[model samples]
Target: MHKGNFKEMYLNTEQLDLGKFKVATSETLYMTVVSMLFVIIIGLILGLLLYNLGKSKRIGAKIFYNLLSIISNICRSVPFIILIILLIPFTKALMGTFLGAKAAIPSLVISAAPFYGRLVEMAFREVDHGVLEAANSMGANKWELVTKVLIPESLPALISGVTVTVITMIGFTAMAGAIGAGGLGGLAYQEGFMRNRPTITLFATICVLVIVFMVQWLGDWAVKKTDKR
Candidate 1:
């Protein structure tokens, strides 16, 4: 009877170590914010490049899309763990270490950039072609069309795209914990699971859940506020 008491042990905790919980949560939030910033900057550049290249000619545009599609496919094909491992050397060179929040930035950015780029590309694609034509009809230059028409029209979709990117980064940050990257996932893995501390594990899980839900709520609010239609 005593041997089957795992469930009881798991649920016996009254609370978690708040300091560990806070440190882990802050690391996760940092990683997600930095990754999102990189994704936004890189995604915007890629999207603009696609748009510019696509507008040159019918054949050229198809070629551009095909190239981007292939790149995206390749990046997407690599699993995140493998990608992180593969990038460890670069992370070290850039960050002087590859086992903490700073080191995880490149991997997070590399993983999410293609993702957000595609989102941005698709968001821009959703802009009305006729509106673009109308902009051109009004002598809107390329930059003007991009800033005034394309981006504004797709602001809501872009916000949604960022939401998706942030959520994805949260998952990635959890995985980064294996490399001594401090986050709730890492805390759960190292202190809770490995050390047999159920209270710590439960606390970490709850923290992640709260963060994810909060991000989702904020994202929904931003979409509603930005949506023109």
Candidate 2:
């Protein structure tokens, strides 16, 4: 392997334009934030449904739980890259294009929501059964049980799970960028790797790492604030 000069690589600015870098960074952040909102909202609802249905003794509820579980599993099992390709038609129909940051939102949400839903379900399951029993004995309704008891008790775990999910979404954005989604990943692939400019690739990678670290810090802070125990 031909290892280029490190100092020259770092100092070179001929190929790395700050303006384009900013645009790519914005695209990455946009995709991640937009998709994360949908993922969290939809995943939370799905998780709650799975939890409630699984707890019921009714045969119909059991059937529905199994059905949802299967679907969620299928979504989670598919790789994100293939999922994006598979959803191209849907993306075009929804976003009017399947080749930019906005178009990547549907694929990101679909791929990440079920994964986050499973995390939410696991977090809910980890809630203390004794607390649930106490709430039940006090004549708590289903809504009260979920909103006041279940979610509150599981808030810390939920935050932690969301933290993980957000990080995963960042990675998904990079993958989406690889195929013309126009983020740092696209910049790296097109302007750096293909054009033999290692500095731009390195720069984009560092930016991604910084974003991930910031996200991890915020998540930990949120979890600590919410955790009562």
Q: What shift in Å separates residue 91 of candidate 1 from its native position after superposition?
A: 0.5
Q: Rate the local accuracy (lDDT) of all candidates.
A: 0.85, 0.91
| lDDT (Cα, tens digit) per residue for candidate 2, span 1-229 | 3345775775477767999899999999999999999999999999988888888999999999999999999999999999999999999999999998999999999999999998888889999999999999999998999999999999999999899999999898988988989898888888888888988998998889999999999999999999997
**Model 2 collision count:** 0
Candidate 1 structure quality by residue, lDDT tens digits, 1-229: 3745865666666546778788899999999998888889998988777766666767868897779878877776788878999999999999999988878999989888988888888899889999999999999998899899999999999999898889888988988887777788799999888888887888787888888889999999999998978
Q: Candidate 2 vs. truth: CA RMSD?
A: 1.6
The estimated TM-scores of all candidates read: 0.91, 0.94
What is the number of backbone collisions in each predicted candidate, taken in the order shown?
0, 0
Structure candidate 2, residue pairs in collision: none
Best by lDDT: 2
Give lDDT: candidate 2, residue 217: 100
- Candidate 2 residue 184 Cα shift, in angstroms, is 1.3
Give the Cα-based TM-score of candidate 1 against the true structure: 0.91
